[model samples]
Target: MLLEGERDTILKTTSAVLAEHGARREKLIPLLQAVQEQLGYLPKLAMEEIAAALDIPAVEVFGPATFYNSFRLHPPGEHQFKVCMGTACYMIGGQIALDSFERRLQIKPGETTADRRFSLDQVACVGCCSLAPVVVVDNFVEGKVTPTRVDGLILSYESNGQKVEQDSQQTEATNTDEAKGEEGS
Candidate 1:
């Protein structure tokens, strides 16, 4: 059930996007992208509307949406946590860090918290190889993150705290110092 304004906006935008792309089978992916970008996630009503617009079956419309990793069926939470599982990070205990986040948050990857506060996901990499076991919290890259640090990070977001921001800076500095120590060793 969409709010009146939301229903109107989605209908208008989906129609405009469909009109711009036309009713071609080849244009399906682009059509889905446009609708998701405008609506945040694909609502059932919007999907049905898109199917009707494109003269395709509803299953045809849903098939690609579910197949693509980029599209989200539900709205995202306020905060998004993406853990990088690159080779360097994984060798340095990325899996453990991910497990820690899952255990602490009580939600597995690709799931949002029941309170709608946080969402967790595992990415192939955040491109911060130096920051092995990196976790991107709301777009801030945290390096050398351990299981203990994951707890503190979640707590910071709770109760209106900004420690996560402060902690990211400290973690970067700490990681740098640790790297120097390893080189000296």
Candidate 2:
């Protein structure tokens, strides 16, 4: 929940937006978009506020928000994870990647962790076919991901934010460590 002042700010902005609608139903999209832009996701309270100010039904406000894929009814996770499930990705084990996440997260696709730290979702394609088994974690599209790679991905996100360069370095270090461990064994 937002603090009073923050909620006021959102309400002020959204109310002004709704005021300009002049009873046009189409205006709902942009109004919702504006409020969502201010807040990452639309709160139920915001819908009620909008309904009251606009003289519209709360159900009317919810319909468009629910219809749009970008509109998040609940607060989104801090880190977003998406796996490509396109034809190519599927043939190369996208389902397996999805399973890896379900097992680790204990949540199905389109759900978030209880801690609100990670959100999991699926997309038809990430547009990187060469990397058929692709997983995108916080906008870093990883290719040829194995199940173990999911753990590493989660680790990176759970840890302090790691940059792409840091990821490369860590991958190298991990490979080297694995080689050493194998040699020792």
Candidate 3:
């Protein structure tokens, strides 16, 4: 679904961003983010919407969505899963864990399940290298994950309505604290 309330704000922001860049075609990133924020994913229709709004060609907008790994063409899964493959995570068998997920899910990375319950992708780094071999489901990050841990994560969510990983909550708390600290500083 295209997000409505925030879509206007995003539109305003994109328009302002365009005004700042003097409507140059180079400001595509922010434009794309605005469209993504509105549509949840970049609907093919969004290319037309953005092109008309920005006075650019639809191809101009579509090209980047195809070009960037981060862009989404379809509605994202209800839960987005991100695996970190940073040097530290990889050394700790991150690839093995990812393979386990793919095998079990029967869908490759960068693809969403038919039910849209889960979508998986990889990140080069999430800056949580200390938590080597990590996977983040939705917003919850699982640290120090082993290949053996995959089923537990799946079952934990399946059994508990998908909010199973306690570690992710703790990391989110830490992030909030840091955000507060930054504001105070």
Candidate 4:
């Protein structure tokens, strides 16, 4: 369910997009694209608003939205994990790598984590048959990905997040000390 503020924002943005695209059935795809571009993903309320504007059933809008793999229904996470499931990858052990990610992240493919830290997806291929069983982490491809490698990858990212937090806290403390020194001077 969307918060009241989020619902209102979606409604307003959908309204503006409808005004630009008009109520033409031919413009359905482009209209949806425009709305997604603005909002990053299509919320349920935004889709309903779009359907009403086009004078079509909500299911009609949902058909194309769900049909296209490019369209996302939910917001993505900070990190994206794309596991290749092509013939070569599958033969090599892509499924196992994908299973590892699902287990560690506690979210299945096409789903983001509850904390919004990671989103997992399985793609048909990453065009690296030579490097079968590949996993793409935040656009960086890792070849020959195994279950153990997946665990290490997740740990590295988690550690990096903690390091960033600690760095920011240290910077804040330094700024506070400098401010105190200036006040004394």
Best by TM-score: 4
Model 1 scores what on Cα lDDT?
A: 0.82
Residue pairs of candidate 2 with colliding backbone atoms: none
Candidate 4 local lDDT, 94-141, one digit each (tens): 999999999999988888877677889999987998988998887677
What is the C-alpha local distance difference test score of each model?
A: 0.82, 0.79, 0.72, 0.83
- Taking the tens digit of each residue's C-alpha lDDT, what string does model 1 give over 58-152? 99989988888898776566788888898999999899999998998898887778776888888997788998989999868888899878876
- TM-score-wise, the better of 3 and 4 is 4
Candidate 4 has what TM-score? Answer: 0.77
Off by over 4 Å in 1: 1-9, 161-163, 167-185
| lDDT tens digits by residue: candidate 2, 1-94 | 4544866776776677667664366667777777787777787777888777668889988887888888877666788889899999999999
Regions of model 4 farther than 4 Å from truth: 1-5, 162-185
lDDT at residue 129 of model 2 (Cα atoms): 92
lDDT, ranked from best to worst: 4, 1, 2, 3
Query: What's the lDDT for candidate 3?
Result: 0.72
